[model samples]
Target: MMIKKLFALFLMLLWPSLSMAQTETITHGSLAIDRAVMRAALPGSKVTAAYMTITNNGAEADRLIGVEFSGAKKSEIHSMEMDGGVMKMRPVTGGLEIKPGESVTLEQGGLHLMFMGLTERPADGETRTLTLIFQKSGSLTITLPVKMMMGGHKTSS
Candidate 1:
């Protein structure tokens, strides 16, 4: 009985780290992609968004040309802007550029990945795969965790 109680206490102490979402970094050539996360899709919602940071570690510049995700029928790099007191979202044309030794962050209310026609709605704690195609770095595949947005912050569900 004492051993069982101690084991339970140990698990309780380790629960937070076990339940927290883990951030993963994937690299290809001189490009490193990190902090990749997708928002949990609400019920009956066919669209969702993802965000990440891409860093260029080499001397040459590169462009993010395309994205691939099997869970969605279409994926595009998008940007949101306020135009004359109105918010507008549009697809980024000609790809996004990343200069040498610079990091480009795709985040909410700015640049992000727009996934439309979702074949599967992502739930909290789910892991999804995303393939990023770059102009110079080629293709890099990264795994992203689906996190719930609560009060403008990400939380594990």
Candidate 2:
């Protein structure tokens, strides 16, 4: 009798979940930050760099408007371009464009975020919270892990 009672209780608990249908979540577009960190900058330096990858899984295109960080006085989008056989980095005033079903990679020698007037250097094994504001997706909060000066994976505070 006890066994039957337990089985009945289990069935009752499972009924609700089985009856409820699951629906797929449709994200018009999404961005994933692979890894972001700040390089060692001189004291009172006016510039630093951040690298990451922006991915769009949805069917529509998206735009990354700006980024905000606590340790930096100013954050701007920048890209590296070839000028007269020389690599020159410049600020992208219009922001970075992400096409539909595509991913824009911001690696070390290409596109990156320019962090100016860093209030303090992000030490190794520390985590920094950065907010990325998008043209349509509003804002996304990401915790970037601080690595060693030599680069590679460390840990986020």
Candidate 3:
């Protein structure tokens, strides 16, 4: 199915990070979030991004409804697509869906977290707490350690 293939592609892109950060996964009931990291940004920069993998372990689907952080003036779930060799990014209109027993990855050049109007620049090697609201799980808070890059330590072009 198309959904299966898309999920598989996400998994493949996330495979390297998963293999390297096996111990970094955080689980609650039927949900798990892995390798959640925020990219480093220069001061005065208006935007930054975060990446992670979210998994549902139960026999029911869930949706990631919202993301919150005090450091940014605005936080949004964004998706990126390549159009004729051009990369375009935009906010995801609806919430991101997660299937039962399935994992969804948010990474560079795809579905990701976008932070704008940062109150303060994200610091490297430091941790910031991010609250994720799920359709079924209500809210789950996790520490997002600020890092220069993610997923095999590769930076975006």
Candidate 4:
């Protein structure tokens, strides 16, 4: 009886960490990518977005050339901006540059990874693999957890 009570207490203490998003940081050359997350696709929606922070820690600059997602038929780096009182989204041509010693954030309403024609809708609490290709660093793969964004807050579904 005492061991059962202790086991329950241990689980209660460890639940928060287990439920949190994946915190793994992937690095290639001087580039480090972290805080990677993908939003769960809405029902009947075939598209979703991913966001992350990329930092260049070396003296040379690098460019994020492309992305590979096995779950989607197509993926592109896209930017959203306001133009002429309207919001416009388009694929970023020539890739995105990361200057030396600078950090670039890919977030909502800005630059993000657009995954289109998903083979299957990713459910909340599931994980997916993403490969980021850089001009100088080659390729690096990272795992992203699917999360739901509600009212500007991330909640595990």
- Candidate 4 runs further than 4 Å off: 1-23, 151-157
Per-residue error at 82 for model 3, in Å? 1.4
lDDT of 4 by residue, 35-72 (tens): 89998887877788899999999999999999999988
Model 3: per-residue lDDT, tens digit, 32-106? 888899988765676788889999999999888889988888998888887899777778877899999789999
TM-score for each candidate, following the candidate numbering: 0.80, 0.70, 0.78, 0.80
Candidate 3 achieves a global lDDT of 0.82
Count steric clashes of candidate 3.
0
Question: Which regions in candidate 1 have their CA more than 4 angstroms from the true location?
Answer: 1-23, 150-157
The C-alpha local distance difference test score for the whole of candidate 1 amounts to 0.84
Q: Distance (Å) between predicted and true CA of 134, model 2?
A: 0.6
What local lDDT does model 2 show for residue 2? 100
Model 3 error, position 5 (Å): 46
What is the lDDT of every predicted structure here? 0.84, 0.69, 0.82, 0.84
RMSD of each: 10.2, 9.2, 11.8, 9.5
Better of 1 and 3 by lDDT: 1
lDDT of 2: 0.69
